[model samples]
Target: MTLVEGAGPRTGAPPEPLRRNREFLLLWSGASMSFLATRVTAVAYPLIVLWHTGSPLAMSVVSTAALLPLLLVQLPAGALVDRWDRRRLMLGCEAGRVLAVGSVALALAAGRVDVAHLAAVAFLESALAVFYRLAERGAVRNLVHPAHLPAALAQNEARGRAAGLLGQPGGVLLHSAARWLPFGFGVLGYLVSLVTLLFVRKDFQAERTAPARPGRLTGEVAEGMRWLWRQRFLRAALGYVAGTNVLFQMLALALILRIKEAGLPSATLAVVVGIGGVGGLGGALAGGRLQRLMSQRTLLIGGAVAWTLLIGAMALTARPVLLGALYAGTGFVGAVFNVAAAVYQVRITPDAFQGRVAATAGLIGSGTNALGSFAGGLLLTAWGALPTVRAIAAAMAVLALLAAVAPGLRGETAATPRTAEPVDPVEPTEKPVEPTEKPVEPTEKGEGDR
Candidate 1:
């Protein structure tokens, strides 16, 4: 009944396929519903605000509120996830999101949708989502056999891309029908996720031999930061991912600007972005196979180089179709990189630190997105679209070169060995501690991740 961390499939035995894993299915289904709903509402927020207020500044304010959680709530939410029961935490998040989103629907139905109320709901829903995601990231390792982790995470990556592909279009269509429809759908999605979690039977973390003593919130957050800082490969990988994320955000804005400058129809922009999403989804589907064939270092370096070429290609084209094709290539490479990075981070982190570590990485990777958007606007205003894109491509080239020469990436292998070490709550130590209890065969009661 007791499953050990990092336990692989038995020798000479094929690993159990994920299709037959009930726990994983439930977890994946729930998380997928929630993620899709989040994206739908993400689009709906700006659309509804614009439709009602007709103020770009108001729309921007609401959108910014939605993203603020990634910066403000991640660390504390992560610390809380590690401290609380992960499954229960996720349940609470779902419940809170249901109410937050439903309130928006109710307000819209009653014709009382104020900008402040909308912004508050946006911030609350986003903050709860942060908690749910961190807990879900930790829960994933416990749900599947170690050998299946790559496939599991790959599927998760695919889920996210698919959501991105569908959610915006769906939101637009639903909003055209009724302003409250998207929020109503979001409420339903969270409800389904909540119901599914209630049925999951497996523990979300390894059984602790002793109860952990609660520490100061700041101290607990610091523990995760310190632990992550000690991992050379992860630190380097995070840095690389963060830098690329900022550039990609910039590139996204530039693409829109280019389309506008060229007087392309709005549908052209949709086609370009949709094609890019398809590419990301395809890459995610292939990520598990690709991970088996390439080392983490190769994927990182190759992806960076590929992105440089793709972005540089975009700078040469004002044609919508050509730009879409190049953007698709970048999306493919980015998806593969994300899968590899997520698998590596999850495999090596101890269950206890999973939330904080995952949160910290999320913060590092996505924290600068607003900056990138702001910079993209400034650069476009100052130098124009093609020139701005050329600058982004040049910056990406620098990142590619860094990936190639970074000392931390030099020793990375195709498969990272399990290096998780137990942390003593009262007196934390840097060294690994051997478990006194032997690991037993895993049971089918409950297991899976998001």
Candidate 2:
């Protein structure tokens, strides 16, 4: 537990989790801060739009604009990441996002913000966010031992979910006090996130092997997609995850509206969501062990079925209390499902391939999410909320059955060798260190400019 300047006392136990994994800790802190702020943005984005425009579709456009950047930027950005210094890339991205979002906040405060400005800001921040996240995730293996990887990822998930729990509620509370409060809070969090990144020693950076010579950009991108495409287990897991996002999202969102329709108190809805958080914490913590016991394919397929059934049950139930109980149960399963997919994806993917492969997955995944949200809104508008929910449940059902039993997915475990599991999947008893140095060098001051 070596002291990291201004980082406060090490809250962790005496054993170093990633060997002298000080950089990983710093990176975690950086990512966690940014993610926490994003949660506030997540809340403020919709509420602010609603207050100004009085349209849910306007809010949906904001989400769509943010996501559209991924499809256009990810593959090219991934290729660029393979060529660039991942650390500098992340630094530039963080600094860029801070200004981008901060400028938007400033404009909003000045009463000059509009839909176009909001959309542009969302697009810019999301573009940087895509590359920054890819680099940061791509850097993980260089920072830690294979054994600590699983625990590290679990802790990351915990941070994200924890942020979601705290940030959303806090953002709402602040916005209730004042519309601009959340944006200000969001800016502060992003700044703190950027600042905390400075303490990490650069010598412990994630390393990349030299890229293949003479390969065309398009060819290299294809190679990565092909590698992942050939992996039955990974693709199958991706299928379930992709389907879950595409199919069940509307149902998930509709839960709140349903409670309102049934005359349930919004406070009771908060209690239900809080209960889901508890379940999520447990699931995230247990993710690795579960993966070890059951393959990702099994877990994903099972999780999908469980969530669909619970959602359908909620849709059928007349009582708000039972529906609320169902929400808690489904959230627990959903969290674990996410952990399973992410762990497997991270594990099977080679370190050199992380940036591109992850970007491809993220692009498709995010696009599907945007599409689902749009479709959900339109369907709910046309068919009414309850029937739209039933339609989503039907989609989830079809997705579950079609995806789980598909020929490509059914036997993925057969191809996976026990001894061949990537070192990233297993937890180590000791902190693992890189072979290049004895101890890490000192931290450097962050450059103020991009």
Q: What do the candidate models score in CA lDDT, each in turn?
A: 0.82, 0.66
Where does candidate 1 stray beyond 4 Å? 1-14, 413-450
Pick the TM-score winner.
1
lDDT (Cα, tens digit) per residue for candidate 2, span 1-450: 111111111232233444346777888887888888777876777777878899889988887787677789999777667557787788788788788788877877787648777878788888887888788777765565443545566667777788888989887898788776777776787777677677766532334445444557786677678777777656766766676787656765676677777787778677767777767877776664554456655666677678767877776874645665777677777766666566556555655566777888887787788777777777766776678777776777777787766887664432111111133311111212123222221122111000
Note the residue pairs that clash in candidate 2: 19-431, 19-432, 147-428
What TM-score should be assigned to candidate 2?
0.78
- Distance (Å) between predicted and true CA of 317, model 2? 2.5
**Whole-model lDDT, candidate 2?**
0.66
Model 2 misses residue 441 by how many Å?
Answer: 32
The number of the candidate with the highest lDDT is 1
